[model samples]
Target: MRCLENRVPPPLLMVIIGLAMAPAITPQLPYAAPWQWLLCALLVLAGGVVVSLALRAFVQHKTTVNPLQPARATSLVSSGIFARSRNPMYLAMVCFLTAWAVLGGWQWQWLGPMLFAAYIQRFQIAPEERAMLQLFGRDYQEYTAAVPRWWRWRTK
Candidate 1:
């Protein structure tokens, strides 16, 4: 399982999971209407914006955005969208998968997003956080204490 850490990209994993879940969901679910499609489009757009904001923050901080190498990050970004979620990229992928599920009108499609979150938490975010804790030390610790693993309006 350790070998799976950061090996498969989150976006690819989302797509694969989304595709795999769709067939099981679609046949058993109702068809989406125009309003649902519109909502799905909005969700995809929002997801894209979330990812873009995170990437821009990384670029501005001159930190490595590469998911495979958390040790290579030059800085700990805690401003902008990073202040809201430690893993906006992963959150964005979750949003995208959710939107895809909505587009298909899959009543049981919540599993796709749930599975993605579970996989990311175990294989991706956990390893990345460990690496960040090692690389950034106290600063990253404080940031984690302030921000969340995923988006939340208030700290808990």
Candidate 2:
């Protein structure tokens, strides 16, 4: 997170910039069906919003938001949506970013989200895991061992 904070652009900021660059980012001729486009947009926004809300609540109630310089955690949270994905936030971002790239209508914009994933993984996700492992030890390990890094079908 320290690396993410100091070396990388905020995810939100990068998303906004990519959106604003749509004129340049988009394909010159997007021939996709209007309904299909709408569906894609909705799916992305819905996924992003849902994940964002979950993360916000988790940060507020279960953990600290300042991953860069984390304040001590009050508890080890492994219930709720977290039981499914060890990185729901990342999953959500991927959905949102995919929709965003589709909105751009150009193959080039796909790299934006991919880069975001790479950055988050390397800078935030990896470091945060190290910290959590150190902080919670075996309990954290158990939780992560059960919940996958990304996809999950079981609700409970």
Candidate 3:
């Protein structure tokens, strides 16, 4: 398990999980309604926006966006979409997977996003955080303290 950390690319993992969802391993749910298709489209669009923003931020900051080489990052991006979620790219992937599951209307398909999240949290994010802490030290610590790894809704 430890050997698997930062080993598999996230996009590859996502594709593998998506492929797994194609088979009817569990009971299938009812077909999606027209409204569900609309919702799926919205989710896919949102995911694209998030990932694009995250990549743009990295580019603007001149930081490495390569997930496998967190230690090589030259900047700590904590603005724009980064301020909202530390792992916006991963969040975007989740949104995409969620949209797929919803559009497919399979009971087990919903697990794709959950499994992706869990795997990313343990294998990818943890390692990246460790590298960020090592590289950015207190600045990274303060940023983490102020921002959630994922987005949170404000409770009024």
- Compare the candidates by TM-score and give the number of the best one: 3
**How would you order the candidates by TM-score, starting with the best?**
3, 1, 2
Clashes of 3: 0
Candidate 2 residue runs with Cα over 4 Å from true position: 1-10, 16-23, 26-32, 56-62
TM-score preference between candidates 1 and 2, better one = 1
Model 3 pairs in collision: none
C-alpha TM-scores of all predictions: 0.89, 0.75, 0.92
| Residue pairs whose backbone atoms clash in candidate 2 | none
Q: Which regions of candidate 3 deviate over 4 angstroms?
A: 25-31, 154-156
Question: lDDT score, residue 13, model 2?
Answer: 45
Give the C-alpha lDDT of model 1. 0.87
In the range 19-108, model 1's lDDT, one tens digit per residue, is 888786666445667887788799899899999999999999999988988889888888899989999999889888888777765467
TM-score of 3: 0.92
Best by lDDT: 3
Error in Å for residue 117 of model 1: 0.6
Clashes of each: 0, 0, 0
On TM-score, who's better, 2 or 3?
3
* Ranked candidates, highest lDDT first: 3, 1, 2
